[model samples]
Target chain A: MIRTAISAMLLASAAPALAEIHSVAPGEGAQERLQEALILAEPGDEIVLAAGRYELTDGLSLDVDGVTVRGAGMDGTVLDFTTQAGAGEGLLVTSDNVTLRDFAMENPKGDGIKSKGADNIVYYRIRVTWTRGPHPENGAYAIYPVESTGVLVDGVKVTGASDAGIYVGQSDRITVRNSIAEANVAGIEIENSRNALVEHNIATRNTGGILVFDLPDLPVMGGGNVIVANNLVVANDTANFAPPGNIVAGVRRGTGIMVMANEDVLIENNILSGNPTAPVMVIAYVQPYDDERYNPLPRGVVVGQNTFDGGGYDPQLEGGEMLKAAFGGELPPVMWDGLGSLYVTGDAPGWSLNLTEQGKGLGAAQPAPLAAPAPEAEFDRTGIGAPAELEARLSR
Target chain B: MKFGTASLLAASLLLAGTVIARATPPPEQYVNDAAIMDGGLPRLLSDYGFFADAPAQEPVPEVHPYRLNTPLYSDGADKFRFIYRPAGAQISASGEGLLDIPVGSALIKTFAFGEGKDRRLIETRVLLHRADGWLALPYLWNEEQTDARLAVAGARIDLTTPRGEAISYRVPNKNQCKECHGLDREVVPIGPKARNLSGDWLEQMVAAGHIDRMPQGADRLPLWEHRGKSSVEDAARAYLDVNCAHCHRPGATASNSGLDLRWEQDDARALGIMKRPTAAGRGAGNLLFDVVPGDPDASILLHRMIVNEPGVAMPELGKATVDEEGVEAVRKWIAGMEPR
Candidate 1:
């Protein structure tokens, strides 16, 4: 009886169908194998992968609706693109109602798992990794889902990447649950997405944890997210794990949450303790003045009722004198409030208003040119070797 | 870069380095000052404060007499050991407030002068409901500063929703009011002196037959009815008679934080720091969410219950007892301090 009930629950919870991958044996030619699989894949048809490693030369695109490609396991099946040159989008899935589960797609010259213009394309138990050697000219992303909808990523593990562990962009009705995203420049970043739910996931020991950002001017603005619950969002202590350049210096200093231009996003009931610097950060939303993707808001954000305990360190200072010294000789004060508990929602009146002409609910207007004091042409070689002696000192 | 001699030498050196690294202690590995001084301050205060305020102070005429006239609330069908009765038990600074409160409830014990030098006031514990839920009077006194009080503005109420789910809320005001007052299932409010009846003037009145004896203690005075978290209602009685009876019972600190947590043991109406959270800032709730019924560890109030940091810690006075054992006791008390 117990077995029957368990099976019934599994059946009820299990998605409509299984996603499979086409076989790419070690002895087979990589091009023929992938091309043949792409040709045979129809809408909703799965191509199951057999155990072995296959090296790719050019990028592969699957634009069919409901087409799924799955693998044996991350370590079991390897899509090695070590020798590929100028390849585009390693495993591109651009269709709706599709699913990709249990796979390893590694070291592409371009986006690791890039999917565009699709809906309900779920990726489950997928492991996307990189090779240390020949480190393809560009093996950047682990899993990149852009301009998609209803993307649920569960039990997926990503490792050793220069970019986000899982980057989901401009989608709605998405859920990323029970996954481990660590050791990447940024883990589980949601850019221009709405109504996204991130729960039961361990996003710890990463460069950055769960960021809700809006990349404006690209015709996208994120709003209404639920960073409902999770734990152990600590500092990315690994030195080599730091992002190239000061890609994110101030508001992005090791935050469990980096809240940008968004609204009505609830960050509640999560253990936001422990992180070298801040466990939570609410960055200034100044569009076209500071950041390129700033959508200056009419209202502020909510920093509500969450407990913050330790991992105590904040290099950023509130006093004008301190900020000047930290960011060269003279710079605008980037002091953030509403950190400890119960910060306001929708444009805190306490903070200075940075309203745009359009933000006054006037007719639409062009986004101001990014006034970000131009990024450094050459990113300084990150201190990839110096481990923070301070980080080694903290723990509870 | 080679495959033989140079690589072998580098690998050997790396191995040797690993071995040497393990052999020596890093600078941080050595014992630091923090390791030794952690539980120091909080410990001495608890010990020193306990002794100085023990039946040792000059006896006041009458502290909290309600504990002598009330019956201890027993948990059963109703779930709560007590019930609430508004207007039945009320007190204020003007000395013109309602009395005749039933046993087992918490009430408002506001204090301030109507116009007299008679500074000492009545013990408070019966409860009432208004825009805020059940309000309590929490005023803790340090041994060194008896006149000083750490009163809080908070509300405590019991609400059974239309769905038949009973929810208790304790809205905290400006300060971290939930901390020190929280112990047992109910916040163990500090009495006028030490957390007992020997220090109360009302108990003296009861001893002198001015009022009826509450169903508690060896002499039915309200203190001896202690049974850990179970009989904390009596403890709650002992709490109010001394703490709020002086100030909030009539006149005191602007009713600092505007909360009165004094429920007579006889009345046992749920008191201060017990009610639903209120929205403070623009959509920001003053109470941390996730106060699920039956599970105290997940409650945000429990966090304040165990916390001891300055602005975040409870009582906001005399720093909580920080001995590993004492802190643990506080933690255990808070973890168990869910609405009974």
Candidate 2:
């Protein structure tokens, strides 16, 4: 019995001692060193990338669980993929409980820093830039996390993507806070996901700022239970540079905080300015779909108190001049398609399309002032956002 | 039971004869079975002793050569495949699924380019079936054609394809191998399913006592050389099964897209018939649906295969040039579909 107790104590002390640090420096053979460090790392190990420029030709990946990849700073450590010849992304993380922080990737041929099926992942203080401004040939997304649960993205900056700057798709329990998404097609988009909290972010100079959508024919469906609050969405008047046939390519040039085909979404306490399109728009899915499991209507969407300034002055809608003249120069702060359920907490001025059903053409709409009823009760705040334990990693 | 005993006796006799012939054997002449089961990574490809002559592509005893019915296109480079089985161990097989390779076994494949005299081996990849799981590793060949060293980060080489296009060839890194061989977060072998193997190979293995029995669904995929005799649908389905099904099916990396191109998938909608893309982004390329019936020109699935762009290309790795033959087969199948 005494021997058993001593062995158990030894086992307990061995774990922390086994954790190691693998430091990689940038120079001639940084590609081999950094990639070897990523592949050979063990669980609970840390891989540190020193401050320099890494000229990489191929993509890198990590599949070790509970590993942390850190850099000196987001600006100090740059992974330049200007001459990238292969692979689908700049860096791919396929392991669970991984933390990636303080690194920047420039001019990747595809999406930048994609994490698929990597649960409980944290992406902190990272930057992904296209170098060239908005162009149709830029990579799809800057920071993409898909098909995973418990994702936390904090203090990241992304720019000049043809698609969404920060896109989280087909996942649950996501929190995107204190980030900046600029000069992309759609800034900060949450698609086909659930229980998301997008707060305290700055979204500017894109085609659409802050979109929450539920697309059809995905593995996970019925995206809802989202809260978009305390964000600064302004001046998203850049022309849509997304390649044609993408869903975001159909987005208007100056949209702010748009929610499409979702359920039980709450938009509150945001500052909207310099948006020519409607400051807050809610609508049904416009395209025809064949999936029986899909519901293309926006239901239980509530708009709470928000500040709107200098918006809707030059709306980007069909018959914009006629609508402006009808509304006595400049439309209202909110726009609805009149095919779904919407609630307003106060007297927020808005207009509606007044369409009868889904998949109806815009020509069938009868324009009228919005007459939304007040919300019935308090919105449920349970089981939202990433798990609180993810914050502890940032502190470490 | 008596027949099984007789076959086992004969197998042991054959092994004993081969061992007696190599009395003063050079150390590298035999396979290193311990290296296959060990936990540490071997630094060089020759450390495993898979090849008796590292330059001539010769195999040692108990190493078997195999071929697939329809192979994946890797810029038209020739592939040499081998499987190494330890003494007294057997490979188990089910109907049409992947072969159940036992622990301490390894699969080696070498990719080479050019004709008889100018032939150069670029890289050799191995899949070691260890105790924990299958581990994939890549080794790069040297300029002298002597041996290959382990390259965890992979390398790029400039070469000309068979189609006369000058391009850069990329050898996949250690983790990049998992991008194609991963299922449910575990590394696995993508090729060597029973359906893709020939019936004659299975019979020969069974006779030699290397495998338990003939697989039920053996020799189902159409051969690439004899594709002219097969139907367009058969060839097209075989191409999709070998090239696209690794990541497109459920529980794989691209599972979020909701498209399943596996051979056994029967549902029309699951096979991307008029299915809209969820997150194709710029890869959609002005196309609406993934597959438009009777219109190959409008199908996003065909467009992605034809394009050479990085983000838009299908089978994101291992192919730098378009397969014109594969594209024609898929186009014919799609053109024959009935539009609804």
Candidate 3:
């Protein structure tokens, strides 16, 4: 401890302007002490939390820009909010250029580690869990970053969220990679966002895995330019436990790599296994919206090469038994609602509902074998991830 | 930078004139300008000297009391509001927007329960306008009601609210204060918008020379006490503007929800009329739209307001119990709407 403090002092003196470390430990008054450090921290300061369980009551927040809040490790330093009394989230970050890593929050009454309107934020090596596993009353989102530019969520694990785990909404230049989203309603959902790169994430045991969507009547609209690649999407057949009135409550249980109401989306290089429903589902927004600015179609979506194994064995469609029997005891891998511009490459067997327009129910479907054309050109790969400068903060 | 320097020089010149005109030594009622301008956090509420008698909730000389047309409900706790401007500084107005108080000003609000001899101060929330921006802090009152101390992470008091419900009243933490006061990534004052301030109070400030003139949109919101004399829509909109607009407007905390309830917003969709929920997870309560015309029970906007749970509640902070009166006003307005 003495050596660490001495080195921190040396670093502070060397910089003379930035790099001040405020170290806090868990004990009585841990809530006040840690929250005070977060509130009073200056720009470029680091608030280091020692390894222990912080039994906090209310929510904590950090609004100082360019600050770093680090803990010993995800398991070593746990922020236990089992008795959280008030506030919307366990930890709220409303400032820019903030880095939070190596910590865990358990059983918050609301969300866990929400960063709203906080730009260039990096959340690394963090873990958020309900501890009681899947339940309807769990917080909405874990590791949520919304309405921000340049968001990077790397090496995080989220479980038992009633809504999406690692949910990024209405943001641009985002990357969510090297994460584990398990037992949540929707694992790793990118909604109402643009220029996102979701790669190399392990998404399993959730209701749906890796959803790229665009909903209407949001401040930031027209979500597109997404790349969902190189991930493990398997066994996402968990029953949807989302609360009533949530949009995620409508998600099918065994969906994998679904895209809705978006354009220029590329889904490729994923390992899909053990998913009972369709391995890849592409469709449009089903709800009728009054916003004129909204186009409820998935245009220019490309489904590339992926390894599908043992999926669609027990389908969750409207007529599962008849459809599966007609398809030789197991349904095809890809399922489309037949309302969008979908292109598939490399000859993946699939089927389509052949819906005529948006907001049509299953009664309007004419189910048939899917036939889609190859893409005219390669998918655009420009500016499709978090800014490269965000990775530098993780190294520190 | 140049404007700041010039303003400082002008303020100092005005201060010199006041010093020369004074007959006796300035009383101890003077506000501590250093405390407001200091970068360090004041440990105790008394350190800022905002109140002459901290227990009695009495303000110092430059601290002036003001009342809004319709006030926000905080578990029915009676609020004492005050605005403190430096002796030489001046406040300017801009239509119905926020009054541009000088950088050294502060807004102080104290929450108390009970009346007369039974009154007990619960907490005090202060907004200090430093050079950088507004800084909000919460202070928890002691059991003796002598002075409140800074509760940086906030505290919960197991006390009975005005409605006789035994509840844990929450004192919002420093960052939670920013949740309601934040605008466009900056902490700002939310209550002193010109439309919400009473017209008589504006004219009084103008007569006192603290303000240049009465703002254009002064006294537009329906008065809370006289809501029966006004339209139900005006009363409900005033209640929502006072309570929800701080976070629901554009560039605020709930701005991503696409519901802007500010008084000046005339568009029906922008006001959450038949607008679908965006990020209102379980708060939507199985309702389809935010405001369902002619169906108060089906409106998600009213549904969130009446609930007191953490994740499901609107305003998300500073409220524990249902504001039944506020709910009734909104219910009447929604019920009166013409259904499409």
Candidate 4:
């Protein structure tokens, strides 16, 4: 009993504490108020927001580090900017060590949530929506992280983007986990960045899903990212078939994720399933053939241990033949419902294709500051971990 | 009286000569096939209307074998290719149907085509070479077969000169055959199936009194093997409706804003271009003006319909499984539409 008490004290000492905010609504220049609080805040100050919609035509950028702005609930604190009467982003951040929870940063004339040069950012139970209830058009990205570092996107729901949902570009030491991105041109785009940990994120119903892209022959080289244990895709099976041009043109390719000329990327412990066409795609456009002259061409992508669920060209239509003729022998299938290890159907009871890290050393990694030496395992998946006890503990 | 007769005869002779020269041969001013289909893949899909159920050209087969023989024996021309069009058009090929794919993989067809010793085999592979996925071609990016068995087969490729000289290219080992009938990415349009009946091929025959418009609504005569709803003309229209409607609608890339390309055309205001927005991106398909009040030449759509850039072709579907005559049909229609 004495040892247990002493260990608890030690445990408390190792962790940075949390701050909490109760209520702040309308008449509160919520902007000015937030700014003031941030200035007064130290490390781990929590600003719990009241249930209401906050509009910032010019948006708000966090000034302090280690400050968190939380909401009462994900669906409750609605921040809309689609028809925003301003010309700036909804919310932009420049400080690191910030945590946001139970809030929805939505619809901006510019980017939804633009984090510039920030890092170690975490969002808990946050829903960033650009879809206008049912009619969304050109609703840009949900979480836009550019030139930042150490971003942790947790339990965040994002949708409806003209471009991408969770766009991480030119960043490092990042982990985007336990989030949902759908109805965007591209979902979870990691471009010209490095050292990212992408897992437990569900990207569906877009022209292209989670992508690691670099324009070959261009000066930029996006490399060295780890995409472990995330559901990178789904078929854009929709009952709502709007008019042909409802969702704009140029967005048609659907998939779970992609690795385009990105080197040293790890795609493990994830389920890539039910994409209308391909689950994961790797594209490398080189010089001479491609018009854009690259100073240096893109190469090196190592894909392994991930399950590519049932996906492929529509067999009912005529796309199958075209697919085969283009890739030569590389064109295999667009679907994999039973390739066991990595893929699972959401329709299945309790996610039939769960992760099997039974004998591995990483002990079922979470989306925290994932520091580890990954074991040389044979398979990788895009499925999230369901550590019930841990989840329960974290929620509390 | 004799002078009048001579003058009349001379005028008639001059008219006949002009017509003969125009019909004789294509001028050297014509470029190659590589200059026709450019842009990217999305344009190809939109231009063709790939999703909407339209009448099929071929009669519906009573039974389709799980494993087809068409893609299996390429007669030495066994490879996959990607054909792209300007933004929002594409045709993809993979390892199924004609070529056996791995199981859950796909490849986007490009100008640089793929070749395989065995189109249907999925294991023990070697990637020998890579080509420009976006090579220029006339009509839809053009390629052909050059293998012995296929040459022996009855695959007819007609090569003709302006002087009516004919050379038949063999369809044994060349580009994948299903180009005209696209294999992936929504629908296939802009390919070889279009080579015939373009310009005056069918029209000249009709004008020569070989055929006439039926007194009824449409002449439901059997043409090729493909089958579905509607007459041949209606089916062709349906093919256009399904393959191109997506982008041709208002506020889309193909949208002259006020010009709808669905089954029922939309008014100019409905199509969006009372004053169209400038194409936003640098490499965008937003060609400035499509209907310069009355001039089709001033129209961006017309310019795109007959393109030469691999990066900006209209109906970007390269000849993955079909042909370029389909694009010609669209071009003919676009050239003839009267402004509202």
Candidate 5:
């Protein structure tokens, strides 16, 4: 008995210390208390918010690494910024290994949740929404992670952003899955990023479903190796409400997926339907640009096995002018801008369109005429195999 | 009697030497104290005494006191009085052409409204130079207006402007202040550039021993009222430089857009002339380019400037109302542009 007691005591002593949990309740100065908790938290500390509405003026920022901020539930705990007077983001994380979960941010003056130059950030079960619906005055982004690495956003629902609902820019090794994006300009945008995996997300009633784009003159470039698969992208016929001069403004109303100026992107196994414009579009980054460092061609794209239902009727005449001219009013399920360099020495082309097991209606438009000619034989199924293999090769 | 006079003279000289030595001590090491009082306030401000007298008087000349070339336009609600206080003898200019203020310096900007008997002080934002980085501290004035208290989380004050406009002035938190003030992901001063300070202020700073020498060929940024006085291009560029360049400059927060509006930037694309918007959503206002050469109405820059919407507005923060005069100036400049 004595030996057993000693062993139990030793084991108890050997275990790590219990992490500190700071709880905040709604009160006159609840925001202040929460802010104090964030500032006072150490590594491995958890700051929990009770189930109530907390009205905040200034946004909250966490710079303590290895801290966890949790709420009672996404629908129970609410952080409302309706009367926000500051310009800072709702929840700005500038620390590594920070996990934010089970919270909802409402009506921020700026971005909802933003992480800058941080790494190993995980956001789970978070909802960011504008209460007044979509307008030009809405915040720019719902969940914006910029210049970060190893970011994982899962089970988040975002809506009513003037810009992209879930935007990952200038980041690397990002995974956004099991999210719902609705009523935003671009539903889920992976811009100027590398090695992103977007899968199993439900994108509906947005301007465009998913976008993989590389903008010029950013700190990071050469965005590639993006896999967008097994998602339900449907009825994204929302009129592009994005303000002018943004790259998303060029997106057609009903585009399911768009790949612009990116390389080695694999699109597979998604259910795309009810999009009036082309379901999938591959185009060059031919906007009037001055940065010479950016590559403007989409190369090595493999599209396969996506179930398409009811699309390409009543296309956006103005937004999809090129596509409309090429394939008439009834657009195709997949479209490509056939403008890129040719392979000089090798038997293969610089950019190859590998389409297999896709449900019909695919077309390509030449760069010069901007009109529909006969389908080019070179772009017609260059014998690329399964999308999984292509994805594996590209990722490597 | 002669011996007594000699001893008295020696004592006076000793006292003078003590005073001089105390005035010119090395910069104090920084400590990250959450409570601003822990750093020993009232004493820190009084000992350093960047101002010549208490309760807002003249500035101490030896502190290398200076002012901005053009002030950033806050909401029409409050007016600001800005002063720069370098820690040591002089400010060393960095190779990147920005003022490398030594640690322990401070940028003090006092926000107030009205003048004379109706004047009411709002708050003072102090950008303290620390070893790790610049720390922003906001001190809210008491009702009596005799003193201020350090408010870290920030405060909101409702007041009427001199123009009879009722406004709610939001004192930004420390992170909010760093939002635009951060450069290359590091907290730095927004103003005090060679191009912005190329006017008489540079000469005055040089004369007061604030800087060793003035940078050659530095372009001067004119005040906003100089719209009608100077060339339209100069006035427009100055307005953008003061209001937008802090975030729009290269390596700054808005550099992701590929637009650099620093006064020294000569590239047409960097200046956003005929440049397409990168990530602008509805901020583009259906315009084709940021600037459409000869068409101001068609320029997204002007559209963002004129709008008060959250996503479409330019400068994004610090202003609740539009600066009609600034918008008109830029409009005239763009209207007068020759199409490329």
Candidate 6:
């Protein structure tokens, strides 16, 4: 008993004396008070919100590093932007080592939660939604993190987004787990990102579920080493409401899993059901882009041991006429564009499709090389490098 | 008793006049509520003492004033006056072509509508240069027209324009002010570039001792709408430079698109001619290219500028309605361009 008391006294003395908690209640000028609290918070400080509805007109921003913004509960503390006057994201975070938890942001004019260029961020039990349901006028993204690293999004619920419900763009080292995305155009999209693991998430009633894409003209290109496994992708039959010109606008209505213009991707052990068109689709980025530095090919894809059910009943022909003609209105379980490499060096063809463990579905159509072989040219082994090299390049 | 009261009132008026006539002191280095209030700056919207002794509207109104070569169009509201006050010393030029003003400087812009007694004052945005960094403070005027108070979280005012059109004006919060004013997430001034400060304005600033020297051979930006003052191409480029270049430039938030809309950009692809958008979504309007040389209808730039939907707008902030004049200018420029 004497030793325990002595250790407790020592621990109390070692704790920082400046740590503080600021609690805010909903009232007039509550938004301003919250903004002031965020601006005045120091490192390791916590700003807590009471259980009530707070009406906000303008978006809030936080740039103080290592601060925690918490609420009473996700269902209890509500930040409603139904009458927002300003544009831009609802909560813009530009600081490192920040944690946002236990709050609900609804019906912002733009993105619901956006973190830009920040690292070591965590979002826990946060919900973003449009209360008016799915519409084209909804915000673009519900939970968005761009150009960030070491991001963890856990136990989040998102819905009613015109674009992707959970979008991680041009980022690295991201893990999105235990999240639910519903009634969005593209649910849980990972675009131009690397070293991402999306698992244990429920994506339902969206236009497309769990898309991994690498488009041209972005600062960070060539996404690789993405693992999409152990997720429930079901009944993504919502109509595509995304505006044109975005790559997601071309996403078919009932696609369960899509991989485009990326390499070193593994899609395994996911339960995909009730998607009318296809369970898995892989294709190239065939859009015309002027940037010469971008590579628009899907390479080194591995599909293994996924349980699929109730697909290939009705397909959306706008996905492509080729697939419709090939399947005659009932699409396959796994589909590939079958467009081989344009540059025909003596290298092992730019990429390979390993379908070793795939079972009881229409097999992928591996396209033959279109270009003639050049035996005298040196072999270009750049595209077929080891996974470790790809991971290192992505980490940088 | 009446004679005694008259004499007492006369004495107080004399003392108040003496205080008002004295030279105003410079503003403090850092802006706080108490400091600004104690400094005795103009509190009312029509005080007419902070800038010049004359009325609000004039050709060259106020002290040490400058204007952007091509101003950003905020809804349909007009910025009748743009002025600046250097705290202690002149602004020095930086190597990156940005003006590095001293810590105590303040950039003041007043947004107003109409003229004379029917005029309505909207809001004034003050960008105060502080010791730590620049601070954005927005002051909203009350309906009594007596004084304005600092609004940190912004306000929404419903008013009718002189043309009898209704508008809901929104004053940006402190954080939203940093959206366009910041570069690489650091809050800095976006205006006062060498290109925007050339010609007679540079000569005048030099004469008034606001800046040490004028940059020579600096490229000047063309005015957006001055009644045929500049060519169509110049107007279009200037509009894009002011509206989109703040985010679309290199290393900016929208730089992932690879479209650089800065005034100094020369590459065709970077200029968005026949260039595909990176991730425009519905903002693309099903258009193939960002800017198709000879077709304005097929251009994504024009489509985004004309639309006001949540995911379709170009600027992505501070505007709920489209600027028809800006859209017409860009349309005319695209229509006149020769096919490449």
lDDT for model 3 comes to 0.87
Predicted complex 3: DockQ:
0.51
The better-scoring model by DockQ among 4 and 6 is 6
By DockQ rank, best first, the candidates go: 2, 3, 6, 5, 4, 1
User: Could you arrange the candidates by TM-score from highest to lowest?
Assistant: 2, 3, 6, 5, 4, 1
* Model 4: how far residue B215 lies from native, Å: 89
- Each candidate's fnat, listed in order, reads 0.00, 0.69, 0.57, 0.00, 0.51, 0.47
Could you tell me every candidate's TM-score relative to the true structure?
Answer: 0.41, 0.93, 0.92, 0.42, 0.79, 0.79
lDDT of 4 at A148: 58
Candidate 5 has a DockQ of: 0.33
Which wins on TM-score, candidate 2 or candidate 5?
A: 2
Off by over 4 Å in 1: A1-24, A133-138, A238-253, A286-294, A298-300, A304-307, A314-396, B1-340
The lDDT, on a scale of 0 to 1, for candidate 5 is 0.70
Model 1 native-contact share = 0.00
Tens digit of per-residue lDDT, candidate 3, span B106-138: 999998877668878999999999999999999
lDDT of 6 by residue, A1-396 (tens): 643554465467743233567789988987788887876676667799999999987778887887888897789899998877666678988788788989999998788988888787888889999887778778888998888877788789999988899998888888888899999998899989888888999999999999999877767888876888899999999998887666777888888988888876767789998777667777677565656787767766666557777554666744345544554544556655653222222222222232222222225534222222333333223322112322232221
Model 4: runs farther than 4 Å from truth? A1-23, A35-44, A133-137, A216-220, A237-252, A286-298, A315-321, A324-331, A334-396, B1-340
- Tell me the deviation in Å of residue B180 in model 2: 0.3
Top model by TM-score, which number?
Answer: 2
lDDT, candidate 2, A247-272, per-residue tens: 89889999999999999999999999
lDDT of candidate model 6 versus the reference: 0.70
Tens digits of per-residue lDDT for model 1 on A265-355?
5555456544544455444333232224445441234444455554324433344354335445433211133222124332211222122
The residue-level lDDT of candidate 4 at A201 comes to 77
Q: Which regions in candidate 2 have their CA more than 4 angstroms from the true location?
A: A1-18, B1-29
Scoring each candidate complex against the real one, what DockQ results? 0.00, 0.59, 0.51, 0.01, 0.33, 0.35
For candidate 6, write residues B173-280 as lDDT tens digits.
666677677677677777767766545655555555566777754336674446268888878887887788888886665765678988778888788888877656
